[model samples]
Target: MVHIVVLGAGIGGIPMAYEMKDLLGPDDRITVVSNTDHFHFVPSNPWVAVGWRTRDDIMVPLAEPFARKGIAFKSVGCRRVLPQENALDLNDGSRLTYDYLVVATGPELAFDEIEGFAPQSNTISICHVDHAVEAAKRWEEFCRNPGPLIVGAVQGASCFGPAYEFAMIADADLRRRKIRHKVPITFVTSEPYIGHLGLGGVGDTKGLLESAMRERHIKWITNARTDRFEPNAVHATEIGDDGQEKAHHVVESRLTMMLPAFRGIRALQGVEGLVNPRGFVLADKHQRNPTHRNVFGIGVCIAIPPVEKTPVPVGVPKTGYMIETMVTATAHNIRALLDGKEPAEEPTWNALCLADFGDTGVAFVAMPQIPPRNVNWSSHGRWVHLAKVGFERYFLRKVRKGISEPVYERYALKLLGVKRVQEQTRETTNV
Candidate 1:
């Protein structure tokens, strides 16, 4: 029997385990290890921070679901990965060996990178349930005393969607409280343009996002580098084409929410040849580590080279659909390797993002997940909000039931019209 060990139980890891169980026979062994037993619905974190949702509404335990699928689940944190020996060192001093290993621990927020910005400093984050809860408390306090608001992503940050969502939601919350005018909101980002989004502006993203910000009266500072954060202000710098720079206005923010840059988890850090300089595991097109065939990585834990350069640095964005595609491909390849059959390489992921903008939401699909795409579309309406709510309920149910449905692939191909586009592209190229 082939023994497989998966690290982390986040969105990427849970789906990978279910898919693996479905593909492999009952005789095969699968183990999932993580520090926490509950899996948090990260996309709803913005709503949680705004007090629209609670922790219980967004978290589900992993033990019951894994047990139902016949997979061994451990709540021990990973201390280190000895890939050379095909073993994992746990926090409890026990080493688990495996025929194959999957790393999906996700990204760590580097809050310490900026001055006066630690976990519980002048700023707040909605990256996790605990953080979101704390942020909600701070937000309530801010509501009582409405003032300037600073919300956005910093340099080298890939997850821009949440920043946009949080800003919009905050605006809506203030309006509901009849304090919208009292609170001056500023959308500050490191992107060269308003809608760069770390993908160099998906089709019409620049126009659409800019219009949304304008309509909301949300001021913006583009190509901005946040130097640090004081107690009630954010210090930044903006550069121009002439190689000249100007000191950015110190926006007095009573409440600030900034998404920090991401790095790989500590367990896989410093593993020679296995991870890149940023500590993210480096995998081939098949999601298998180039140096160790038995090792695989998916989702934010994996290293992806930047698609292009911007005035300020940018990293690849890992959307939910993109992560699911990588998980599916990794499971299939791992199964083939265990069976001693040649593995089929998986194609690059296309991104599909549905960002909720309070009263309504915007949906976008980008082929190849970067600029210069073949198909891209965006729309905003109340139905988009309804669709988002339905997705949340359905996803939670699926996770709780341990259902290994191929909902991701079908959703991707259907929504993006990839199959038809690929067929046309092929025919055109051949002619």
Candidate 2:
């Protein structure tokens, strides 16, 4: 019997394991390997950081759910991926071999790239649940002593949504506390322009977000290279179009939170032919590794080229919708391999996103995440915030029930004429 091993248990990995299980043979074994036994709803981490959500509200134990589905589960974590041996070396001196391996392990936050950054240092983060808890405490301390606030993503950072969300959420929270007047806010980013979001600004996102930030009285600095974070200052350089540092200054704040660059997890690094220099998996359009035929990749762990070059480094984001499509396509491709057929399915990589600013929010849809797309649109409303909340609840329920794709989710996207995965080959489409 073939054994399919799925690494990581975050958003992409969990759903990937569920979908692949459904497509595999009854006799085939599926094991989910994750560093943590609990699956945390990451999108809610910012809320957690701001006291809106607790650990129990968004986190779910994976053991019970996987056992119910007759799938094996491991949370001890992995030390390294020995692709040559086709085995995963565990952190506890054990190894698990797999006939087919699915690398869904999410990103390893590159906090070390910057000096005096991260929660333990001058800035705070909401990338992980534990980090959010720590950030929550910091948030309380900052609230007690209101002052200047600096919020944005640093260089090489891809996930810009959370940064934007945190800035607004923090703004809303401070306002609710009646301390908005005391806390001046500034957003700094590696993007050449505000709202670029690594997709070169989605459908006038530049204009929409800039307008929103202005309305909120939030100042911004783009093309910023954050050099270091002192006790109450962010030393950064602003690069002009000529590729020279236009200015150097210290942006001071009592509180700071910047999304750092993301790199591949340590385990996947140094695995030639499996991952790129950044430790991100290199997969073809089929989501399968060219050299390692039996291996596939999904989520932030996969390498996606930057939308375009900027004065400072900025990686393109792999949003929730895009990740889900990758998972769907990977599962189908593996099933095809099991059937002794070449992989044919390709994920649409559609970009459907909701950026909530507490009470109000922005939503966007890209039929194909890449440019020259069929559908490209963006709008903002309070309804977007409500929709984001609904999504959190719906997604958590799906994870708890181990549902791969709920009926409502499928029908809803179908109504919008968006697909989870494109079934036809590019050649067929060309014909």
Candidate 3:
């Protein structure tokens, strides 16, 4: 019987384990390894930071769900991935072997890249539930004594949606508390423009976001490379088209929340032919590692190039729907290997995103997240915000019940009239 190991329990990993279980034989075992015992909805983190959602509201304990699914679950975590041996070194001095391994550990927040840029340092973070819980406490204190606020993604950051979401959400929350005028909000980003969002401004996101910011009286700094976060001031370098520092500015703020660059987890770093220079897993069109045939990668830990060149580095985002496609493709490809057939399935890599402000939001669809796509659409309204809330509730229910269905394909994409996977041969797609 084949023993498949899935590393992580987040959005991609949890669904991956459930989907693999459905496809594999009764004797084929699946084990899920995660450092945390619970799964937290990442998209709701912005709301959590501002006291709308609590930790318990978004978190799902994986032990019960996995047990109900007849799957082995380990929360000890992984210390290192030994791809050559087809094994893993667990955190508690134990070794686990597997016939095939799916690496979906997600990205390690690189807050240390900038001096005093971590949640423990001068800034607050909403990347994790724990971070958001602490950020909520800070938010309450900041609201009571309102001052200037800074919010945006730092250099080399990929997930730009959360940064934009938090900025608008914070604005909305402050207005409700009647402290928005007291807090002068400044949006500091590494993108070349206001809504570049690391995908080259999806479907006039530039126009929509810039207009929204103007309406809310939010100031912005684009092509900004944050150097350091002082106690009450942020030192940044604004870059020009010539790739040189155009000017240096010190913006003072009492509160700050900046998204940091992401790198692969420490466990997968420095593995030859397995990871890129930044430690992202190198996967082919089929989601299989070029060097390690038995290994597959999905989600934020996998490498995807930037959409275009800008003065400051901006990595492409791996959105929820895009990552879902990766999980589906990996599951089918692995199943093909077990059946003694060549892997033919390929993920469409489509991006369907909902960036919610507390009351209103923007939604976009990129047929293939890399751009130069077939369907490039974006819209903004209160309905998008409602859709985002419904998504959180729907996703949590599925995880709690151990449901393996692809929610995006069945609901989100069907509503949008989009496809999930290509389902064609590698030769047909010229892969």
List per-candidate RMSD values in Å: 2.1, 3.3, 3.5
| Candidate 1 per-residue C-alpha lDDT over 275-393 given as tens digits, one digit per residue, 9 for 90 to 100 | 98789999999999989889999889899877776667768888887888888889989878877886795945878777888788777777678667766666667666666676777
Off by over 4 Å in 2: 406-431
| Superposed Cα deviation of residue 288, candidate 2 (Å) | 0.6
Candidate 2 or 1, higher lDDT? 2
Give me the overall lDDT of model 2: 0.88
How high a TM-score does candidate 3 get? 0.96
| Candidate 2 positional error at 10, Å | 0.9
Candidate 3 lDDT over 215-298, as tens digits, reads 999999999999999979899999998899999989999999999999999999998889998999999999999999999999
Query: lDDT of each prediction vs. the true structure?
Result: 0.84, 0.88, 0.92
Estimate, for each residue in 299-392, the C-alpha lDDT of model 2 and write its tens digit.
8999999988789999989888888888998999999989999999998888877888999988777767778666666778897788788888
lDDT accuracy of residue 310 in candidate 2 = 89
How displaced is residue 85 in candidate 2, in Å? Answer: 1.0
Candidate 1: the clashing residue pairs are none
lDDT comparison, 1 vs 3, better candidate:
3
Give the poorly placed runs of model 1, Cα more than 4 Å off: 241-244, 411-431
